[model samples]
Target: MLIPAVAARLDPGWASRVAAARRKLWLALFHPRTVLEAFRGETPGFRPHRPFWGMRGGVSAVFVERLLTLLTALPSVRINPVGRLRHMASGPRGTVLLDFAAPPGGAPQRLSLPAATCALGLGAEELFRAAGVDYAPQRLSVAFGWAEVAEADLRHCPFSLLLAAPGAPALRVSAGPVAEGGRRVMALEFGHVPEGLPHPGAAEARRALEETGLLREGAPMRLLGVTSLPCLQVPSFDNRRAFQAALAAFHARGPEGWAGQLLCGAGRLGFDSMNEQILTGLRIGEP
Candidate 1:
């Protein structure tokens, strides 16, 4: 199914987060039940609330819920929550998900995600579909992994290896290459982020992006897909081998239960620096 790009400010407080309704645009396009089931699974005895417009609303609710339920209950996926998520997106930023950060000089190896957790994560299509009319491609802000690496690093970095074939996009802490794509520039990430790259703050890079007109002024940063980017594809490794390698790495040291499952990323790849042409007056101006 097609998805949308969504930029939202997450409320950390449990109550506050729960109280906030799903994006209105999404609710308008699809049935609310689909949203609920994706998270809540089977909500037994879920009766439809009769809106002012009576029967029709009720029927609509039922239809939506059933469809969602089928989607949820069927043999769906056994993704490594984070890896699978990053694997499915279509953006450089969305692909570069940050997992737990390594302490200074700490040797880091693999990533792990649990089975149950708030699925704030999604794929590229879902992000776009969620955007609908609400998508304002300004500042792409996502969960920023645990530590906020400079956007400069993210842009040049890859999520995993020199080449992430399937699992995740390669993001390096240091500089990487940006390829020329027809009329667009495709940034290719490879290896780990260089330690010299700015840590907590990347305002300088942010400004540079704005100056270049890649990121606009008031847009809410969006987290495109799961943040825990894993190395699923070894350019030379066969698909089966890559899949096995990714799975084994996680299964051995997976995060405990729900705490591990939430994988997502918000870092962005500036508009291929094609403002004058592609982005020229696309107008949804800043947030």
Candidate 2:
């Protein structure tokens, strides 16, 4: 339901631009010289235009590998012509559209825009920083899906309870049902509060949703799960260590105990196939 609402408001021209940007991103990621130049800050006279200007700031090869790894793991990406791509990540709270493009005489560019009343926060900032790109945040007029919940169950939902918990970080939470294949699952979203705004407590958000009639007490929803765009970092370029640590953590949590997993690129794992290792920790739907 939230997906259709967000889709209706998309700029018709964004698809093509996004495709162009994805292609450029692929080219930069695959080209060894481009990668080297980006890391060293040495512009080879005839370098293929970098897919993202942020790379010019100097990137670590480890970081680059991790970035590519994360990109490859994303379920919602389409790679066409080996370079151009289109991708979208949607949840109950909102959606994130990643568009890339290259214009004549201009740098290869990417636009990371949030939809469905979601706004960019520290995770967005860390994502761009890790990639070494500069981005400007733009706010949009869209509706959050919180209103769809029933009031009677509001106190029981994790979003409300987490916000009400002592020592919980100031956050903006959103929830709704998302259909994946034939199954519908509840998606709980947590985001950092935008800068300079008063921390709107959980009670306030709960009241707003209830007042709007979005909180329905009996919606027959099940399988409460949560996710966030958390900033993942490595002390150095040893991705293998990071991967091993993650793997150990996953094993320690077993299957059901694992709440959610981070979508990260390279640190200690170093070129290991994430499909066989890291991605297994993610709980996509009901157990």
Candidate 3:
């Protein structure tokens, strides 16, 4: 499952700092208390200290709404109301942590939503509890924690695969040359992979990760389904339409980039809310 979330960039070269902040926020949300509440089925909220990089492209209320609209169009992964922290998770149990920046950043931050976009995710456990429902596992997690995928690893990697481990499984993908010498590496696909991938030992590596707890387990186990997708973009310019079209083509399945980018040229770009008309359009999940 891939969750595509977008935000604005404060500096052109703040990849490390930016990645740190993302990690912090994710950590804050994935706590024992929050995880517990989530299992019972409730929507939780979080607001970590804004990282040093300022705010990425998507943060304003309007952007969030537009994102919400995109959410509406998608399936399951709906935009839930932001509330106080409910349940979160306790981890180190293996969650695929990643952060990317575009060309400038040179690392994780560079791999972020080129256009203003990101993702709002809710796992299975959270879903059940939020809807006042029960699940067969009879178990669930409250929140997801922060993780860091090595920049070198993600550099040539295609996309991230999210799975509710202990059940779902690890995301099987190609390793290209990243894992060549059995170096316990991370993958960073500059943007999208060419073709005929599924790296030679990708499946084997995935199985190992599934059991090791890096690719699976931890928070996703209870959260329910997962979300992971491209929040990619090309370059920004006056002729934005041209840029959008090209980037859109790059937005494909399996470790690629985002289909769309947001037009963030306002004060400290933030998120938008698309509850009404915007909030009724899509589908996405662990794929």
For 6-46, candidate 1 gives per-residue lDDT tens digits of 11111112122212322311112335566567458764344
Relative to the true structure, how large is the alpha-carbon lDDT of every model? 0.29, 0.34, 0.30
lDDT of 3 by residue, 1-287 (tens): 11112111111222323342332111122455555666688764445644333124222454666766986898777433343213222113222112322334333231122222434233332322322333222111111112233333332343333332322323232222222343323332112222343322333334434454445432221111222232322123322343333333323221233323222211011112233213322332224
Question: Which candidate ranks first by TM-score, i.e. highest?
Answer: 2
TM-score of 1: 0.18
* lDDT for position 94 in model 3: 29
Q: How high is each candidate's TM-score?
A: 0.18, 0.20, 0.18
User: Residues 166-204, candidate 2, lDDT per residue (tens digit)?
Assistant: 223322334333334423222222233333544333444
* Each prediction's number of clashing residue pairs: 38, 26, 92
Show where candidate 1 strays beyond 4 Å: 1-192, 195-200, 214-232, 237-287
Residue 44's lDDT in candidate 2: 58
Q: What is the lDDT of residue 254 in candidate 3?
A: 13
